[model samples]
Target: TEPLEKLMPIDGYEDMPLVPLDIAVEPLVSSISGIHIYAYSAKERCKNPPADDLTIDESASIMLYSMDSKFGNKSLHVILNEILKSADKNKLEPWLLYLKLFLTALSHLPSTRRQVYRGIKLDLSKEYPVGETIVWPGFSSCTTSINFVQSELFLGSAGPRTIFSITCYLGKYIGNHSYYSSENETVIFPPTQFKVIDCLNQGNGLHIIQLQEIQPCFSHLHAPVFSSISKKPSSKLTFNSVVNHNTKWKQRGVTLTKHHSRGPKPDCLYLPYGVYVDDNQTIYIADHGNNRVMAWKYGATSGQLIAGGNGSGFNGSGCETNQLNKPINVVVDRRRNHVFISDSGNMRVVRWPCENGTNGEVII
Candidate 1:
């Protein structure tokens, strides 16, 4: 009842371990109704004078106090009280409490396992799925190949048998339209009974047309022509002199020379597609037939081999710089300072850094 401090410092207690007074009555404070209690005792002799004063109930109460003090039952009592209050407010039945505890422990065990299993299953399915392979469309024949299609110009030649200049429509309508009779027909020179010789773009909308067998032979005529659209003249007798003086043609300063007497004078020459002129006016020709790319300065009559030469198959650098097999096109990326070639036969696009001829890389 009174504070346990008043009961401390017993006589002949020199052998007793010092216990805090506040902890001595902890077991008594925590004692539940009808629970047994005990006292602290260091000796086994019950016949001692202090033992004679100890009642069974008092001794048991003391023992219970010591046990509660040792285990810090005071803090545990606060936690237990809060738990009981929450349970009561929620009307949580004993069976529900047991169920919740069981589920909580079980829930933690397999949730992680289930998630891992699902992830593995999804990964496996993605790794092995059904799909299809596709084949793309491509050119089938070489007969239709037309190389180096230069600008088309109307040529007038002398002679009564000179293939009378006639424009025929193969599709929809069929008829012989004589160039000399059609007023809408574009004529670079007057039809004054003279034959046309050479024609070339003279910048602007004017073209220089040379007349052959014009009495003085080689008379030149500067006539305006409209290439953007085809226009028909209103009269069949008078030639339309309408000229477009604003047209500009890309000037690719490439000149070809017959170096060898070979196949039926190549009607046309094929250069790789996308070949461009650099700012420095360098021309890169993807000569697929020769299996090499030739670089020529603007207006140069000869070119230096920049890539593969007239070889057949694949190899590395130098004279063995591999064959170009059927390289269909060539392009230059000035910004990237690189050149790209469509190696059709190899089914890939090869790239080479500008100015570096032998070293190359493939881009699919």
Candidate 2:
């Protein structure tokens, strides 16, 4: 069978209207033997997806593929991908119904934008040269864990391993719905292409290949339907919780701010009114009684005064641009790189630089 690399076009699958799970994959049952049983079971397991755009049936159809079933050596995924890679268009007829429904479901899944990992038990470094584009023309299975590929359960430690570090922007994160939910699997659909960044041999049989997912000149699959309402059902596992272990899922947390514990002074929270956390985990708080906005970076004890801190000249009055009068709210304009302070006591809103500004300008 020809490989499905470089956006290999399988005819007629994309145009077929999506059908229900029980019937859409029925054509495959004749060829695959026991797929009907798996389809029924997969539907039962995926009655409700973590997102809303796809129907229960569409989600279940996808879950069937996402199951990564293996029986008597050949899995459903392996067979499906093999035929997709074939240059002959006639082989795609039996798969049309299932492919349409499957692709439709994948289109509803919100694209996960981050680095994902996959490993192969070969030295395929020569295949992917730096500055070249490679395509995986099937539902490409990848995991987000670096540890999984290295573990004894997977590729193992002592073997020829080619670790693909992929920066994917259109991959569907389906671990939450997959039967193997703990594996943190992300599926990259057909038309998935990558630009090889670099490939290096890390001695002893290990090779690391870096690839970045690139968009084709035209889209092969339909546009995503769930891009606007991206919030998943309450059960979806977030990327943060997937990577790092959570302790209070252990039920204990140490204090973060400890410079001046409790008082109406600098770095102290005297009825702190508003708090905003940035992408860098910088905490901006409007210290109500202290008349100041404090910025605390991650793992910092003492906070730096960013918006307003009243010293000798504007202690009570707080009319100085360098000070505030009962700052009750604080928000940061990340694009402008400035903090907007609500000077409640002075009845004005002030905008100040969040980093090292000693003065503020009243905006409203």
- What TM-score does each of the candidates earn? 0.28, 0.58
Query: Tens digit of lDDT per residue, candidate 2, span 1-364?
Result: 2142565455676555444465567567667888878988987787454344556556676678876677457888788777767676677798887877677677667797988988888888888889988777767888999898778888787778898999999998877667787789888977788899999898878899999999875544554323211133221111111112221222674454444333445545643556677777776877655678888777777777787665423323546777787565677888999988867667578899978798999798
TM-score of 2: 0.58
For all candidates in order, the CA lDDT equals 0.31, 0.69
* Candidate 2 Cα misplacement greater than 4 A, ranges: 1-8, 47-53, 218-364
Candidate 1's residue-wise lDDT over 62-146, tens digit each?
Answer: 2232232322445322332232234232322212222222112122221110000000001121112123111101100001111
How far residue 275's Cα lies from its native spot in candidate 2, in Å, is 52
- Candidate 1: where is the Cα deviation over 4 Å? 1-254, 258-274, 314-321
- Model 1: lDDT to the true structure: 0.31
- Model 2: clashing residue pairs? 50-233, 247-250, 248-251
